[model samples]
Target: MIIKVRLIPTTGRNEVISRIGSVLRVKIKNKKVDDDAANAIMRTFLADFFNVHEESIIIVKGAKGKEKTVEVRDKSEEELRKIMDSIP
Candidate 1:
């Protein structure tokens, strides 16, 4: 499924802030070295956070921007809900 995220880069730590309605607010701890660096950090960090391969996380939009649209292949909304519900 596709989801939207508001990425806050160069934060003190990498974290998933909260679920603000439809958007997932995230913060990257790594310093903003460059646009590619920022995007790489996001991909790897999110991959670990969501327990998926880094290759599976596709930054469909806003690669160099703060607001990003990510696509996770094959997963459905219900599946995502189940996973999030399991996280505490």
Candidate 2:
């Protein structure tokens, strides 16, 4: 499944803030972290959230920007939707 994410950095914590339509708004702590570090953090958090390995998640676009397009392997859209729904 392909997921759109908007990352908000330096929020003092890593979490999924909200989801609007096909986009997920996420926040990550650390104002000094670079783009690569931020992306790695995002991948790790998402892997745990989706119950998948870190290698299964890839940032297909917007690697240098706040917005990113992620591709998730080994999961169906319906399954992802269910998992997303479980988030509070």
Candidate 3:
């Protein structure tokens, strides 16, 4: 499934904050990290969150910006929503 995400980096912890329409708001915990590192962190977090392999997550766009377009392999939109809804 392809999803839109707004990544907030250098936060307290990696988490899915909320979903607003088509966009998923997420936060990453690594402070002082570069853009590449932040993207890696986002991929890893999403992989674990969606119970998919790290290679299954891809940043399709906005690699250097807060807003990103991601491709998640082997998951449907409905399944993704279920996982997102379970986030605290």
Candidate 4:
């Protein structure tokens, strides 16, 4: 499924908030909102947070901006919500 996210980079701490359906509000510390950094961070964060493979997370939009649309190809909505809720 696809998830729309508004990422807040360079925050004091990192977290994810899920208020809207299939959308995430994220804050990542010391991260740049660029192609390489965003892709790398998205991969790492998803893997670490969701216990999923890096390949499962894809950036469908906002690759160069803070607001992003991500594709989680291998996860169900309930599974994704569990991961989001698990974020610190």
Per-residue lDDT of candidate 3, residues 11-85 (tens digit): 588888888876888888866333888889999998998899999999898888889999999888899878766
Q: TM-score for every candidate vs. truth?
A: 0.80, 0.88, 0.84, 0.72
Which pairs of residues collide in candidate 2?
none
Per-candidate Cα lDDT values, in order, are: 0.76, 0.85, 0.84, 0.71
For candidate 2, the per-residue lDDT at 68 reads 94
The runs of at least 3 residues in candidate 2 whose Cα sits more than 4 Å from the true structure, single-residue gaps closed, are 32-34
RMSD of each candidate relative to the true structure: 2.6, 1.8, 2.2, 2.8
Q: Positional deviation of 75 in candidate 1, in angstroms?
A: 4.2
- Any residue pairs clashing in model 3, and if so which? none
The 10-residue segment of model 3 with minimum total lDDT is 29-38
Error of 2 at 70 (Å): 0.3
- Residues 1-88, candidate 2: write the lDDT tens digits: 9999988876577888888887888888846333888889999998988989999999999988889999988888899989777655
Sort the predicted structures by lDDT, highest score first: 2, 3, 1, 4
Clashing pairs in 4: none
Ranked candidates, highest TM-score first:
2, 3, 1, 4
Which regions of candidate 4 deviate over 4 angstroms?
Answer: 81-88
Which one wins by TM-score: 2 or 3? 2
Q: Count backbone overlaps in model 3.
A: 0
lDDT of 1 by residue, 1-88 (tens): 7778887765588878777766787788765623788888888987887777889899898887788898875456787767555544
